[model samples]
Target: MHVVQAALVAFGVVFVAELGDKTQLLALGFGARHSLRRVALGLTLGYGAAGLIAVVVGAVLGAAFPQRPIEIVGGLVFIAFAVLSLRRDDDEEDDDHSGLSVGRLAMSSVIASIALTILIAEMGDKTQIATAALAARSNPVGTWIGATLGEVSSGMVGAAAGSVVGDRIPPSVLRWLSAALFALFGVSMLLGFP
Candidate 1:
Protein backbone atom coordinates (compact mmCIF):
# COMPACT_ATOMS: atom_id res chain seq x y z
CA MET A 1 0.00 0.00 0.00
CA HIS A 2 1.04 3.61 -0.48
CA VAL A 3 2.52 5.36 2.55
CA VAL A 4 -0.20 8.00 2.57
CA GLN A 5 -2.91 5.40 2.37
CA ALA A 6 -1.34 3.39 5.15
CA ALA A 7 -1.10 6.43 7.39
CA LEU A 8 -4.64 7.53 6.61
CA VAL A 9 -6.04 4.09 7.23
CA ALA A 10 -4.21 3.69 10.52
CA PHE A 11 -5.22 7.16 11.60
CA GLY A 12 -8.89 6.65 10.82
CA VAL A 13 -9.12 3.22 12.40
CA VAL A 14 -7.24 4.15 15.54
CA PHE A 15 -9.14 7.38 15.93
CA VAL A 16 -12.42 5.59 15.75
CA ALA A 17 -11.18 2.95 18.15
CA GLU A 18 -10.48 5.63 20.77
CA LEU A 19 -13.94 7.15 20.85
CA GLY A 20 -15.69 6.47 24.15
CA ASP A 21 -12.80 4.24 25.20
CA LYS A 22 -11.85 3.88 28.83
CA THR A 23 -8.68 5.88 28.37
CA GLN A 24 -10.59 8.68 26.71
CA LEU A 25 -12.92 8.81 29.72
CA LEU A 26 -9.90 8.89 31.97
CA ALA A 27 -8.47 11.73 29.97
CA LEU A 28 -11.79 13.50 30.40
CA GLY A 29 -11.70 12.98 34.14
CA PHE A 30 -8.09 14.07 34.37
CA GLY A 31 -8.92 17.17 32.38
CA ALA A 32 -11.68 18.05 34.77
CA ARG A 33 -9.43 17.64 37.81
CA HIS A 34 -5.93 18.52 36.55
CA SER A 35 -4.02 20.45 33.94
CA LEU A 36 -5.10 19.59 30.41
CA ARG A 37 -1.61 20.18 29.04
CA ARG A 38 0.00 17.71 31.40
CA VAL A 39 -2.70 15.14 30.79
CA ALA A 40 -2.37 15.58 27.02
CA LEU A 41 1.42 15.37 27.17
CA GLY A 42 1.32 12.22 29.24
CA LEU A 43 -1.28 10.67 26.97
CA THR A 44 0.76 11.51 23.90
CA LEU A 45 3.93 10.02 25.30
CA GLY A 46 2.26 6.89 26.57
CA TYR A 47 0.32 6.37 23.35
CA GLY A 48 3.41 6.97 21.26
CA ALA A 49 5.29 4.34 23.22
CA ALA A 50 2.44 1.89 22.84
CA GLY A 51 2.16 2.59 19.12
CA LEU A 52 5.90 2.06 18.70
CA ILE A 53 5.81 -1.28 20.44
CA ALA A 54 2.75 -2.41 18.52
CA VAL A 55 4.20 -1.35 15.19
CA VAL A 56 7.44 -3.17 15.91
CA VAL A 57 5.54 -6.32 16.73
CA GLY A 58 3.45 -5.90 13.59
CA ALA A 59 6.53 -5.46 11.47
CA VAL A 60 7.86 -8.70 12.88
CA LEU A 61 4.56 -10.40 12.20
CA GLY A 62 4.55 -8.97 8.69
CA ALA A 63 7.76 -10.84 8.03
CA ALA A 64 5.91 -14.01 8.91
CA PHE A 65 2.55 -13.42 7.18
CA PRO A 66 2.14 -12.49 3.57
CA GLN A 67 0.45 -9.22 2.63
CA ARG A 68 -2.88 -10.63 1.47
CA PRO A 69 -3.60 -12.69 4.58
CA ILE A 70 -2.48 -9.91 6.85
CA GLU A 71 -4.82 -7.47 5.17
CA ILE A 72 -7.69 -9.89 5.54
CA VAL A 73 -6.92 -10.42 9.21
CA GLY A 74 -6.67 -6.69 9.81
CA GLY A 75 -10.07 -6.20 8.23
CA LEU A 76 -11.58 -8.88 10.42
CA VAL A 77 -10.03 -7.32 13.47
CA PHE A 78 -11.62 -3.98 12.63
CA ILE A 79 -15.00 -5.62 12.36
CA ALA A 80 -14.48 -7.31 15.68
CA PHE A 81 -13.53 -3.99 17.24
CA ALA A 82 -16.75 -2.52 15.89
CA VAL A 83 -18.77 -5.25 17.51
CA LEU A 84 -16.91 -4.95 20.76
CA SER A 85 -17.31 -1.22 20.89
CA LEU A 86 -21.02 -1.41 20.28
CA ARG A 87 -21.46 -4.09 22.91
CA ARG A 88 -19.29 -2.57 25.61
CA ASP A 89 -20.94 -2.25 29.01
CA ASP A 90 -21.04 1.27 30.41
CA ASP A 91 -22.13 0.40 33.93
CA GLU A 92 -18.64 0.22 35.39
CA GLU A 93 -18.05 2.24 38.55
CA ASP A 94 -16.41 5.60 38.12
CA ASP A 95 -13.04 6.04 39.84
CA ASP A 96 -13.13 9.80 40.09
CA HIS A 97 -10.33 11.21 42.24
CA SER A 98 -11.09 14.88 42.15
CA GLY A 99 -10.86 15.04 45.92
CA LEU A 100 -7.31 13.65 46.01
CA SER A 101 -4.37 15.86 45.18
CA VAL A 102 -1.10 14.23 44.09
CA GLY A 103 1.00 17.20 45.24
CA ARG A 104 1.65 20.61 43.68
CA LEU A 105 0.43 21.07 40.10
CA ALA A 106 4.03 21.90 39.08
CA MET A 107 5.21 18.44 40.11
CA SER A 108 5.41 15.54 37.63
CA SER A 109 2.88 13.53 39.57
CA VAL A 110 0.06 14.51 37.25
CA ILE A 111 1.97 13.45 34.19
CA ALA A 112 3.09 10.25 35.86
CA SER A 113 -0.41 9.38 36.96
CA ILE A 114 -1.93 10.06 33.53
CA ALA A 115 0.86 8.22 31.73
CA LEU A 116 0.74 5.24 34.07
CA THR A 117 -3.02 5.05 33.93
CA ILE A 118 -3.07 5.23 30.13
CA LEU A 119 -0.23 2.74 29.71
CA ILE A 120 -1.95 0.24 31.97
CA ALA A 121 -5.39 0.87 30.50
CA GLU A 122 -4.17 0.54 26.93
CA MET A 123 -2.65 -2.87 27.35
CA GLY A 124 -4.14 -5.15 24.68
CA ASP A 125 -6.42 -2.29 23.68
CA LYS A 126 -8.17 -2.32 20.32
CA THR A 127 -6.29 0.72 19.07
CA GLN A 128 -2.91 -0.85 19.91
CA ILE A 129 -3.90 -4.11 18.28
CA ALA A 130 -5.23 -2.24 15.26
CA THR A 131 -1.95 -0.35 14.95
CA ALA A 132 -0.10 -3.67 14.91
CA ALA A 133 -2.38 -5.07 12.29
CA LEU A 134 -2.11 -1.97 10.11
CA ALA A 135 1.68 -2.12 10.34
CA ALA A 136 1.62 -5.74 9.28
CA ARG A 137 -0.29 -4.87 6.13
CA SER A 138 1.19 -1.46 5.32
CA ASN A 139 4.18 0.72 6.23
CA PRO A 140 5.14 0.24 9.84
CA VAL A 141 6.50 3.75 10.16
CA GLY A 142 3.39 5.29 8.72
CA THR A 143 1.19 3.15 10.87
CA TRP A 144 3.13 4.08 13.99
CA ILE A 145 3.06 7.77 13.23
CA GLY A 146 -0.58 7.79 12.30
CA ALA A 147 -1.69 5.72 15.23
CA THR A 148 0.34 7.86 17.61
CA LEU A 149 -1.20 11.03 16.27
CA GLY A 150 -4.65 9.53 16.32
CA GLU A 151 -4.30 8.51 19.95
CA VAL A 152 -2.98 11.93 20.94
CA SER A 153 -5.77 13.68 19.09
CA SER A 154 -8.34 11.47 20.73
CA GLY A 155 -6.91 12.18 24.16
CA MET A 156 -6.83 15.89 23.57
CA VAL A 157 -10.35 16.01 22.21
CA GLY A 158 -11.71 13.85 24.99
CA ALA A 159 -9.95 15.89 27.62
CA ALA A 160 -11.06 19.16 26.13
CA ALA A 161 -14.65 18.06 25.77
CA GLY A 162 -14.81 16.41 29.15
CA SER A 163 -13.31 19.39 30.90
CA VAL A 164 -15.59 21.88 29.19
CA VAL A 165 -18.74 19.85 28.57
CA GLY A 166 -18.60 17.13 31.18
CA ASP A 167 -19.58 14.11 29.09
CA ARG A 168 -22.83 15.59 27.81
CA ILE A 169 -22.57 13.57 24.62
CA PRO A 170 -24.45 10.35 24.68
CA PRO A 171 -22.38 7.18 24.74
CA SER A 172 -24.73 5.52 22.26
CA VAL A 173 -23.84 8.02 19.56
CA LEU A 174 -20.14 7.33 19.92
CA ARG A 175 -20.75 3.63 19.83
CA TRP A 176 -22.79 3.79 16.66
CA LEU A 177 -20.29 6.03 14.94
CA SER A 178 -17.41 3.82 15.97
CA ALA A 179 -19.23 0.74 14.80
CA ALA A 180 -20.01 2.28 11.43
CA LEU A 181 -16.46 3.39 10.90
CA PHE A 182 -15.08 -0.02 11.78
CA ALA A 183 -17.54 -1.76 9.54
CA LEU A 184 -16.78 0.55 6.66
CA PHE A 185 -13.04 0.01 7.01
CA GLY A 186 -13.47 -3.71 7.41
CA VAL A 187 -15.64 -4.05 4.35
CA SER A 188 -13.42 -1.90 2.21
CA MET A 189 -10.29 -3.74 3.27
CA LEU A 190 -11.89 -7.12 2.82
CA LEU A 191 -13.05 -6.19 -0.67
CA GLY A 192 -9.65 -4.68 -1.46
CA PHE A 193 -10.12 -0.91 -1.47
CA PRO A 194 -7.21 -0.40 -3.80
Candidate 2:
Protein backbone atom coordinates (compact mmCIF):
# COMPACT_ATOMS: atom_id res chain seq x y z
CA MET A 1 0.00 0.00 0.00
CA HIS A 2 0.96 3.61 -0.50
CA VAL A 3 0.56 4.31 3.21
CA VAL A 4 3.05 1.61 4.08
CA GLN A 5 5.51 2.95 1.56
CA ALA A 6 5.08 6.45 2.83
CA ALA A 7 5.61 5.31 6.41
CA LEU A 8 8.85 3.57 5.48
CA VAL A 9 10.19 6.58 3.63
CA ALA A 10 9.30 8.91 6.47
CA PHE A 11 10.93 6.57 8.93
CA GLY A 12 14.22 6.55 7.04
CA VAL A 13 14.31 10.30 6.61
CA VAL A 14 13.43 11.03 10.24
CA PHE A 15 15.81 8.41 11.57
CA VAL A 16 18.68 9.92 9.61
CA ALA A 17 17.70 13.39 10.74
CA GLU A 18 17.63 12.43 14.42
CA LEU A 19 21.01 10.79 14.53
CA GLY A 20 23.62 12.89 16.38
CA ASP A 21 20.99 15.55 16.87
CA LYS A 22 20.37 17.57 20.01
CA THR A 23 17.43 15.41 21.03
CA GLN A 24 19.62 12.34 20.97
CA LEU A 25 22.30 14.12 22.89
CA LEU A 26 19.76 15.19 25.48
CA ALA A 27 18.55 11.61 25.71
CA LEU A 28 22.12 10.47 26.26
CA GLY A 29 22.69 12.98 29.04
CA PHE A 30 19.42 12.13 30.73
CA GLY A 31 20.08 8.42 30.46
CA ALA A 32 23.37 8.92 32.22
CA ARG A 33 21.63 10.37 35.27
CA HIS A 34 18.18 8.80 35.16
CA SER A 35 16.91 5.32 34.33
CA LEU A 36 17.00 4.34 30.65
CA ARG A 37 13.36 3.23 30.71
CA ARG A 38 12.24 6.58 32.00
CA VAL A 39 14.23 8.44 29.40
CA ALA A 40 12.84 6.28 26.62
CA LEU A 41 9.24 6.63 27.75
CA GLY A 42 9.52 10.36 28.20
CA LEU A 43 11.05 10.81 24.81
CA THR A 44 8.49 8.56 23.14
CA LEU A 45 5.55 10.39 24.65
CA GLY A 46 6.98 13.81 23.99
CA TYR A 47 7.88 13.09 20.43
CA GLY A 48 4.54 11.42 19.82
CA ALA A 49 2.68 14.50 20.97
CA ALA A 50 4.89 16.77 18.90
CA GLY A 51 4.56 14.56 15.84
CA LEU A 52 0.79 14.56 16.18
CA ILE A 53 0.67 18.33 16.18
CA ALA A 54 3.02 18.54 13.22
CA VAL A 55 0.95 16.03 11.25
CA VAL A 56 -2.24 17.89 11.96
CA VAL A 57 -0.75 21.20 10.87
CA GLY A 58 0.72 19.64 7.78
CA ALA A 59 -2.52 17.88 6.92
CA VAL A 60 -4.41 21.13 7.22
CA LEU A 61 -1.94 22.86 4.94
CA GLY A 62 -2.01 19.98 2.49
CA ALA A 63 -5.79 20.17 2.30
CA ALA A 64 -5.81 23.92 1.81
CA PHE A 65 -3.26 24.08 -1.00
CA PRO A 66 -2.93 22.32 -4.32
CA GLN A 67 -0.60 19.35 -4.31
CA ARG A 68 1.90 20.76 -6.77
CA PRO A 69 2.28 24.06 -4.96
CA ILE A 70 2.48 22.32 -1.59
CA GLU A 71 5.12 19.97 -2.89
CA ILE A 72 7.11 22.81 -4.42
CA VAL A 73 7.00 24.83 -1.20
CA GLY A 74 7.90 21.82 0.90
CA GLY A 75 10.77 21.08 -1.44
CA LEU A 76 12.05 24.63 -1.22
CA VAL A 77 11.78 24.62 2.55
CA PHE A 78 13.73 21.39 2.75
CA ILE A 79 16.42 22.80 0.51
CA ALA A 80 16.63 25.95 2.58
CA PHE A 81 16.89 23.95 5.80
CA ALA A 82 19.59 21.82 4.25
CA VAL A 83 21.61 24.90 3.46
CA LEU A 84 21.13 26.15 7.00
CA SER A 85 22.28 22.87 8.42
CA LEU A 86 25.35 22.89 6.19
CA ARG A 87 26.27 26.34 7.36
CA ARG A 88 25.63 25.75 11.07
CA ASP A 89 28.73 25.75 13.21
CA ASP A 90 29.42 22.77 15.42
CA ASP A 91 29.61 24.77 18.64
CA GLU A 92 26.62 26.90 17.70
CA GLU A 93 24.48 23.78 17.44
CA ASP A 94 24.47 23.15 21.18
CA ASP A 95 21.14 24.23 22.63
CA ASP A 96 21.65 26.39 25.68
CA HIS A 97 19.48 24.87 28.39
CA SER A 98 21.36 26.31 31.32
CA GLY A 99 18.70 28.76 32.47
CA LEU A 100 15.91 26.17 32.41
CA SER A 101 17.10 24.30 35.49
CA VAL A 102 15.88 20.89 34.42
CA GLY A 103 18.22 19.47 37.04
CA ARG A 104 16.20 20.93 39.87
CA LEU A 105 13.03 19.53 38.41
CA ALA A 106 14.68 16.17 37.86
CA MET A 107 15.23 15.92 41.56
CA SER A 108 11.47 15.57 42.01
CA SER A 109 10.81 13.02 39.25
CA VAL A 110 13.08 12.06 36.39
CA ILE A 111 10.29 11.01 34.08
CA ALA A 112 8.37 14.26 34.34
CA SER A 113 11.53 16.26 33.96
CA ILE A 114 12.59 14.36 30.89
CA ALA A 115 9.17 14.56 29.34
CA LEU A 116 9.00 18.28 29.89
CA THR A 117 12.55 18.74 28.67
CA ILE A 118 11.94 16.83 25.49
CA LEU A 119 8.66 18.61 24.85
CA ILE A 120 10.43 21.93 25.17
CA ALA A 121 13.54 20.89 23.26
CA GLU A 122 11.58 19.41 20.39
CA MET A 123 9.60 22.55 19.82
CA GLY A 124 10.63 24.02 16.46
CA ASP A 125 13.36 21.42 16.04
CA LYS A 126 14.55 20.45 12.58
CA THR A 127 13.20 16.91 12.98
CA GLN A 128 9.78 18.30 13.84
CA ILE A 129 9.84 20.57 10.79
CA ALA A 130 10.88 17.65 8.61
CA THR A 131 8.02 15.55 9.97
CA ALA A 132 5.56 18.34 9.24
CA ALA A 133 6.96 18.72 5.72
CA LEU A 134 6.78 14.96 5.15
CA ALA A 135 3.17 14.97 6.30
CA ALA A 136 2.40 17.76 3.89
CA ARG A 137 3.84 15.69 1.08
CA SER A 138 2.56 12.26 2.08
CA ASN A 139 0.02 10.60 4.36
CA PRO A 140 -0.18 12.61 7.55
CA VAL A 141 -0.89 9.68 9.85
CA GLY A 142 1.85 7.59 8.29
CA THR A 143 4.31 10.43 8.52
CA TRP A 144 3.48 11.05 12.18
CA ILE A 145 3.80 7.40 13.12
CA GLY A 146 7.08 7.03 11.26
CA ALA A 147 8.57 10.23 12.61
CA THR A 148 7.60 9.43 16.21
CA LEU A 149 9.06 5.97 15.99
CA GLY A 150 12.19 7.32 14.39
CA GLU A 151 12.59 9.79 17.27
CA VAL A 152 12.00 7.09 19.87
CA SER A 153 14.48 4.80 18.16
CA SER A 154 17.10 7.50 18.17
CA GLY A 155 16.39 8.21 21.83
CA MET A 156 16.89 4.59 22.73
CA VAL A 157 20.14 4.38 20.86
CA GLY A 158 21.34 7.59 22.43
CA ALA A 159 20.36 6.40 25.89
CA ALA A 160 22.36 3.23 25.44
CA ALA A 161 25.36 4.46 23.49
CA GLY A 162 25.34 8.22 23.67
CA SER A 163 28.86 8.63 24.90
CA VAL A 164 30.35 6.13 22.52
CA VAL A 165 28.46 7.14 19.41
CA GLY A 166 28.70 10.86 20.02
CA ASP A 167 32.40 10.58 20.61
CA ARG A 168 33.14 8.23 17.74
CA ILE A 169 31.10 9.99 15.07
CA PRO A 170 31.66 13.56 14.09
CA PRO A 171 28.61 15.82 14.07
CA SER A 172 29.63 17.21 10.70
CA VAL A 173 29.11 13.83 9.08
CA LEU A 174 25.56 13.65 10.37
CA ARG A 175 24.88 17.20 9.24
CA TRP A 176 26.20 16.46 5.79
CA LEU A 177 24.17 13.27 5.49
CA SER A 178 20.99 15.03 6.65
CA ALA A 179 21.60 17.86 4.23
CA ALA A 180 22.15 15.43 1.36
CA LEU A 181 18.98 13.49 2.06
CA PHE A 182 16.88 16.64 2.38
CA ALA A 183 18.35 17.97 -0.86
CA LEU A 184 17.60 14.72 -2.66
CA PHE A 185 14.01 14.71 -1.49
CA GLY A 186 13.64 18.40 -2.34
CA VAL A 187 14.96 17.85 -5.85
CA SER A 188 12.70 14.86 -6.33
CA MET A 189 9.67 16.90 -5.33
CA LEU A 190 10.72 19.76 -7.62
CA LEU A 191 11.10 17.29 -10.48
CA GLY A 192 7.55 16.07 -9.82
CA PHE A 193 8.66 12.64 -8.75
CA PRO A 194 6.18 10.75 -6.66
What's the TM-score of each model vs. the native? Answer: 0.60, 0.57
Which regions in candidate 1 have their CA more than 4 angstroms from the true location? Answer: 58-106, 165-194
- Kindly list the per-residue Cα lDDT of model 2 for residues 56-135, writing each as its tens digit: 77446445667677557656765775575476443222224324556434333556656655664555567877888888
List runs of model 2 lying over 4 Å from the truth: 58-108, 162-194
At residue 97, candidate 2 shows an lDDT of 39
lDDT (Cα, 0-100) at 162 in candidate 2: 49
Assess each prediction's global lDDT (C-alpha) against the native.
0.69, 0.68
The alpha-carbon lDDT assigned to residue 126 of candidate 1 equals: 76
- Candidate 1 has what TM-score? 0.60
lDDT for 11 in candidate 2 is 85
lDDT winner among the candidates?
1
- How far out, in Å, is residue 124 in model 1? 0.4
All models, RMSD in angstroms: 10.2, 10.3
